[model samples]
Target: MADFETILERGGALILPTETVYGLFASALNEEAVKGVYQLKRRPLDKALNLNVASLEDILAFSKNQPPYLEKLYQTFLPGPLTLILEANQAVPSWVNSGMASVGFRIPSHPLTLDLIRKCGPLIGPSANLSGQASGLHFDQIQADFKGQVDGFKDDDFLTGQDSTILDLSTSKARILRQGAISKEELVSALPQLIFQD
Candidate 1:
């Protein structure tokens, strides 16, 4: 935890394992740290990053005016593989959202990642692989691809190699931006109002 704290404080990023896939992580609150992720992955500036929080309270801190239906969704499927897009608060830097009004938040179910988040606060967690490449499912893949690129690597055996299901809840009409561990059918079954955008 101390090492992770030090790395993050110095505007460094980490290759951390999540339940869905290995991710390149940096403090969501730090502009430079978030930028480092973009530099490390060579990700496009136009694409936004998603944040991983320790709890619902952390999500509340970074998001504003969340709908009541989200509470139901959180109760049912948080700390799992769901990334919910909500209205961003001032605490969330514009870079994380790519200057967009909304930001995506996820509470991963992995114990180690959750504990790290508990110690380090919310983190900008995008797939560890470079932009347009397949997401790394194992630590070795991440190491081979990004050994010297990031500041540190936190290894773990991930069960699912897929990404999280991204749902845009910022608008009145809930939409699915990306399908991964959670399917659109599951979301619709869980919340009848959710609409599949893609």
Candidate 2:
């Protein structure tokens, strides 16, 4: 891997690939860099960004009161295409979680992107596009919009370009927020223990 962590350590942002879209990556631990991502995207503070982590252990570290079927989902769809909303613990900062008790976390499937994330630690990765625009489909597409603002860039044109399936498991009732590369039926088939709202 290319030492992408250097820029991240300096509290700078990077444009990297995910299974879905190109992502704007910054250390979730850096409040200033988190703010910089918001500024670059023209995104408002009220909306929270999702953290991109390398493992289920990272998720367990930052989250509390995890659902019973959490590991089942991890074994099934995670590291593929799925976003799980979990209750945030004290380890997660307010800047990354937006003071929300619940935060969305993703363990992206893309090999090069996941490798960099493993090297750098946790990052807040939202779509690389400016707010209100379409999800980034390729490296050049996201890079053109970001231009000189990004500290690093990693491209992968092979990504599916469909957003990950979002499943809200934070609450007592698990629900499907958005279906993307993974389907509701696919998730239900994996873990039939709980009822998933459409």
Candidate 3:
């Protein structure tokens, strides 16, 4: 297993796989690391990155309110390819959330990625690519793009070529921000009570 804790502590960033795509991951607890990710990608500070958490409990910890259908949503789509956006609570650091009231998060299904998150804690994981570029799907493409500048690279098989579906539950009604592995119709079929605006 990679000593991601040390890698993140020293370098502030690493390349790791997610269920959706390889991500330029950094410790959410480390403001400097979070800054590095944005700088590395040339990503605008105004834009927010999604949090990669170990489990459902972590999601609840960072979020403001626990919706009644959260469990059902998790059961149906999580550890799969769903990125959920929720209202952030006090526990979520401003650096991680960029002071946005809403925070996006994922529970990655890829075993190695999941293990790293479980052992090292929450990470802010954006797709491994420069800002405005298409997300890399293969390890070689990412490695070539990053040009050996990062501390570590854990390559793996493509779990899914598509990005995770971005579902916003921050408001009273649910909305689909970005459609990916999961579909809006699927969400409606699974959780019938909630209204959806795609």
How many clashes does each candidate structure show, in the order listed? 0, 0, 0
Tens-place lDDT digits, model 2, residues 1-198: 336878889899888888888888999999999999999999999899888999999999999999888898898877977999999999998998889999999999888889978988799999898899988786776767888888888777588889998888898888888878888778878888868554
- Could you tell me how far off, in angstroms, the CA of residue 82 lies in candidate 3 after the best superposition? 0.4
Point out where model 1 deviates above 4 Å: 193-198
User: Which candidate tops lDDT?
Assistant: 2
Model 2: how far residue 127 lies from native, Å: 0.6
Instruction: Count backbone clashes in candidate 3.
Output: 0
Q: Roughly what TM-score does model 2 have, to 2 decimal places?
A: 0.95
Q: Which candidate is the best by TM-score?
A: 2
Which 10-residue span in candidate 2 carries the lowest summed lDDT?
1-10
Q: Rank the candidates by lDDT, best first.
A: 2, 3, 1
TM-score of 1: 0.91
Residue 88's lDDT within candidate 2 is: 94
Per-residue C-alpha lDDT of model 3 across residues 1-198, encoded as one tens digit per residue: 347778876646789888778889888888888998888899999898788997889999999776789989898777878999999999888877779999998998888888888887788889999889888678887888788678888887855779989999999888888889898889889999878754
Cα-based TM-score, every candidate: 0.91, 0.95, 0.94
**Local error of candidate 3 at 135, Å?**
1.0
Residue 126, candidate 3: alpha-carbon lDDT: 92
Stronger candidate by lDDT (2 vs 3): 2
